[model samples]
Target: MIFNIENSDVKVEIPALKHYSSDLLSFNINKLEVNYTGNSNPSIPACVQCSHPAKPMPDSYIYYFEVKINSINSTRPSIVIGFTDESFMLNKVIGSSRKSFGLRSDGKLIHTAVQTMDYCPKFTQNDIIGCGIAFISQKIFFTRNGILIGKAFDFTENFPMFASATLSSPQDSVLFNFVGPFGFKLDEVLADEKKVFNNQVQEEKVDCRNIFYLVKEYLEYEGYPDTLQALEEHMDLKKTEPSNSGVISECYKSLDSSCQNCETQGKICNFCTKKIIETVEAKTNIQIPEPRNHYNSISLSSLYLKNTDFLKNPSKNSSEHNTKNLKQRGILRQIIITGNIKEAIKYLTEFFPEMLNDELCMLYLTMQEFIELIKSREIYKALDFGREKLAKFRNYTVYYRKNYDIPISVSHAFGIIAYKNPHESPLAAFLTWAQLDLTADLVNNRIMMRTQRPRSCLERVFKHFLCMENLYQETSFVKIF
Candidate 1:
């Protein structure tokens, strides 16, 4: 049956009863509902098992299925809902086999006949029994009528298991729900788990000072080792000093409360509402004392370089060669940002002439030049530039397509000339200041590739955190700190 997963975009098809043992079973046309057709015999029980196990989610999520007991034999009332591995014997009920687990009508949780225990209360006709496996933990849990019944069994080994149900009497009829709008509150359960996990994380003592070293490594990786000593001194001061300001008034307490939950917690507060105070302090000559903490008081401006002044006037601690390279790159960046593609290319040709050999960089410069020409309304010049430079690289455009947007951008840039007012065109995005800024960034990255590592240590750290956050979110619906 095809259906969507709760709280996720994924859609899955569960294997239905297509080829089950024919002796005592009758399946409906859709093959999702099954009924026992054999005589009511206490000794003989019929079970329908899926050939393949439920498909597991790549990430950490509970994979499970549910069964709605539509009708049951009033005399025996014996229906078993659960999962079984490949080793399971199709002739017997699921829990009777060594590699299977099931919840019976008598309120007993059974993992093989040898391992049985009274778990939750008995489930009967019209009741929905949800059985799921938390893949990461390798545990089975059951839910009864939208409420969770605790974990049933912890498996010692991983096995591919499929959903199965056994019927003891002829009157037994069941409907399987694989992908759901399940009766259980799966989203809420996941959210609660996440909430608990986050609370646990919050209670644990995390030395956020590790972030200080991450920043230091990032700055050094980006060629700013001299900034480390200054950063370390500032961090030490922040740790030692307390807030200099007096107690906040009742009216200002709300602002203080808002800052406490800022997204930039443990980093510089760039978009925090509390930065309003700093704006006021900077605009007026008023001195507003703030607590020397990481989140509220510090802004991004205080932490890193906003411009290339550091390259122009290098610190005594910096190497002369590195300073010279940075200064050249800064000039190239400025030239590109100012929309002077010709000047930037000339500057590159004079100093970093080898960079011209890199076709991707050349394509970017060519595209930028075309944009500049278009902006000046030199349509024929732009067309000529495209034919001479951009058109020649069409064969290799596919090769550069993966790493850069230049291929699609080249087409879009050319399309801009079709309009008398290019600004009104759908491809007008290529005309924006943001596009110029991106071109400058790409050129800057191209330069960095020759001189330094492509990605910064800070970017790797954030990516690592993001990966961990995703893993946490897979099991728990909410994000952990």
Candidate 2:
């Protein structure tokens, strides 16, 4: 990949070598390498120099640089390696702003003033720590030698970054290598990158960068510039343009607060508005268990069943009372694929005669053959459809459809098939065990009123905050995320 110096067409601009903290620190970047040379005092730090033309960081890509900490005058957050945008300055510390992130030698991540050790790795003299940033996940990672430590920082906003570093004492120095064992192992990160960009899998861990610095690296490695031109026409990571602080903060706050209640947690919903915009279908096979009979007086189940108050103080109708009485006779059980789908349907029809009018639903139910479910009902056939299929279904669907919006909403109709036992998953207890009785009670509530859609506590807080308007757009608010 070496190019002849005489005919080299590449335009390289290395950072102008200089000291930021007076004559306290010094470094050299000659011969296409960076090394801390000297230090006069420990008061100031040798930080960013003039614009050093480096490859544009990918919207999400991992590039490792070797950091051989040659000396340490003070072990107090001295040497640092990080990423910075065009705003990086020669007179300022490496990570002293929202746009800059630096990994300190003491195993902490610093963004301007904020420092955190949430995921920093140990760095010592001559230890080649691998440094990388994932914009999609808004995470920065470090690896000692070839081992990944963990994500170090959760960055706040998006910025086109370049590999950067700084030193305190003159003896406190570092060397950066962009080639070969780029400090970090490329193979280890390849799968994640592919999953994020190529395979297009819905994963939260994927690093998403709008720019493909890796592509430029490859072109430079292979000595091809023509491909680089064509690459610009394709999808550029810049299109993702990191949202403003207010927007980004709101999103992160929403996620942080709801992480516990989120069924998927950090497993899904990483992209901004991507999953929110897409609609996926839900499927289930297990039939809803009959409502459990209320025997115990102080039981939570009994309380849920008998409670008539809903929304405001709406009164119950005779039909609603009748439905409640019928529901009381039935007991809720986990939906089983092997169980009878007709049984659940029969219960529904008897309790809510209004469902009988839905010709489409009745047609699908009668046509579904549970021969395989019949097999599954046996210990051998009781497949882990709930664990395997339904979980993935929820990951895709996120939430259940309130009403049948599609022509074929077989999601509710859970049984019978021609060739297979059942295509739909059985209504296992895991899927609706805690829900069937409650949903049944809600349905049977005598009060007639519009039910509100469920909203997470995080959503309430975030929306409440977002609703307020400020003329200056700088009204201070408590920073949570």
Candidate 3:
């Protein structure tokens, strides 16, 4: 049973009044408006609180509510609009305790009864006052009508804070716009805060820029000239190497020195050819005979081919002969990306038969092929493929280990057959582009390991940070990915 609809979006509701001091205040039919009925002392105001805490939106990191002054009962109507913890007394002013914060209509900011400061201009009837809580900075801000006033106070506690208001004058009423039809364009405020947070994160992650640079270096080292060229062009970068004292460096120098002679004789010089073969043998620790023709030896030139289009112009030594291996590997990678498992297997068999010897790589390819069949609703074929290829790995302990709980197992993956629409199942997280990307990356790593090349520096860094994230149960480091 695969469901097609996505459920990534979240819904946030507006805060509304739950209950208040019944003796001092009265509410209309709807709890959105409150009025002072009994005489509350000017200093000890009647407080009304919303039903729920001002919970931050997980993505936006803020919560906000606004109140419009509907009427004033006295010449000095001391209305307070702010937030307070549940422990605060409802019979007292909202800002009369340390656990509460408020902006009074008289243009004063108060955190405790004894501590008050001149904050902003005083508000009168018909003025909409908004109070917002910024969780990241732990600051409270106010707005008059639709204009933002400066922040008033900072709190260090993590207690739940509820939206609240206090009235000091009899018959003074205020209307709350919990979920709006708002007078203020709150979207702009949210955007600005998000931007500020991102800037702060960017400043802290200065080293992350080098990770992409490492990836660029890896593409070049792996002989992906086209991909390396595209990456350089897209990011406006230049190619750079970390070291200049390896067999690779010597080989490059030898080729450069002999380029003119090879171009004249229409074939690579034997010195440069021998260096290329030695480089491959050093990396893989596999001995091979010296090739009489460097252009025709698939075993020696598979990784060293610079120009794959050499067959079209054998007489021209400066053609695509150097990139032949890169073109073949690139095609294989594209085949995997396109989810053409059969074509990928055939390509590997034809060019890099050694990859088929990797059990893990074979398993990932077979699993991807099974998933493709499942996606096409070929249930009989999928079941047949699973029984033939995946049955033996049903209880494979390596995949089911606590640290590596892959969902695509015989027991878990076969459960999809029970659903009419598999995407609706809890197991649907495995049926995503993320899953395909994971398979492709695993196969690519296997290929790189088979060639005995060192793992990419970017991959090493990512794995290190991911391990740190798991060990400390912190997500900050993994956010870069």
Candidate 4:
């Protein structure tokens, strides 16, 4: 008996092998013929024949036929034969050549000289010697008399087959064994782990600056001292005034007596003469005796004594002083109180020397307070200080324009102040000026009259502030987006 395998649509002859029914003979089978003819099964039939009719064969004497199974669209197929043990000696022809047996005459199995090749049709007689022996025993085993080769016949031929087999398996253990780290070295594993560890360490080493620390340092360096003792110590008493009419008259008489020679000579009095001599000496790199200014001396002495008295008796005011003396004392106190302004200006100049201009005094004060407020987180106090300082300096713009040869306009000054102190309410007025399109209007008007270019410091400052604000807004927008 022979079995046939065929496609549903195509009918073509396939090669096969055959064995006799009585176990008397075996023969090479030719191609089994087939026809489609629109048949439902579309199969080919295998043929078997026996040369001797007198031989009585047992029902166990089964015929075998080789059937070729091929992949779809393939012209050839791997061949395997099915049979019963009666026609073939299971042990005698187990693993022999195609024309020989791998069995000794004593009915025991023996080795045969036959080599297996991948995808080759070279089969020995032992290849089919034990084809159906396992069927009777109901146990599958590889025999020395049988060819039990897998798809691979050698090491090189096994590689691609093993790889594809691994990929097709559903078991994880099989996959790991075949495709994962089955052959990795210990050093390679350690190196990879080290690389990952180093990357994590690098990520952890980044330094972030603390905003609080920056604010604290700025405040300590730039903020005004809270106590009045520092200011009192730094103030010069000689530049101050006395507090009473008797004291004032006494000081004037003293000056008049010391300045008599200057008056008699018709030269500038000793008071004015002393100022000239100091100025000339400073200019000429000369040193001379300090000239007398008796009124200045008496005023300085009285002011020093009064300041000491105030320190000794905080409850007392200078009651004997006249209005003029009181006014002089007030000016002196203001200078003393604000003496640190000069020091603050010096410190600020170290960082931004352009801010050393006298016009920027209020700016300096506000910046100092800003540093303090940030350090303390006293938001409301800072805001109030900023408002007061900005209001005070708002008029300095006009004063600067009137006093300086530089042709800065009030509008430009406002713009500069607004740019510097954007948090202040007065900055709104400056922003309004910037938004008026006045700069272009002025330029157009100047061109019409063919005037020289106007100074544009304020406009430039305003534009710079606007550009900074735009950049900040753009960066923030990108983060949000």
Each model's lDDT: 0.65, 0.42, 0.66, 0.28
Clashes of each: 0, 36, 19, 10
- Compared with the true structure, model 2 gives a TM-score of 0.35
* lDDT value, candidate 3, whole model: 0.66
Local distance difference test, candidate 4: 0.28
lDDT tens digits, residues 45-118, model 4? 12121122111112222111221211111221211222212233322223232322222212232223354223
Once fitted onto the true fold, the runs of candidate 4 whose alpha carbons sit more than 4 angstroms away are 1-245, 256-305, 313-359, 362-409, 412-481
The true-versus-predicted C-alpha distance at residue 4 of model 3, in Å, is 10
* Candidate achieving the largest lDDT: 3
Displacement of the residue 414 alpha carbon in candidate 3, Å: 19
**What is the Cα-based TM-score of model 3?**
0.48
Model 2, runs deviating above 4 Å: 1-25, 29-42, 49-61, 135-138, 198-481
Q: 118-221 in candidate 1: lDDT tens per residue?
A: 98877678999998876544578899998899788888776788888988787789998876778886664455545655676778886786576567545533
Tell me each candidate's TM-score. 0.53, 0.35, 0.48, 0.14
Please report the candidate that would top TM-score against the real structure.
1
RMSD to the hidden true structure, all candidates: 14.9, 25.2, 14.0, 32.4
Q: Model 2: per-residue lDDT, tens digit, 1-481? A: 9867887677755434333444544446353234455434535655653244333233224444555566564557667777777767644676787777777777777776665554555566678877776543446677787787776667676555666777665556665565544556555554565455543444436443312444433332222222433343354422322212122212232333343312232222123112221211011111111222322111212111212122112122223433333222222211112133445365446444665554433333332222223344532332344334333332221111223212223333332222243324442222332323333322322112221223323344456666653311333311100
What's the C-alpha lDDT at position 469 in model 4? 75
Candidate 1 clash figure, as a count: 0
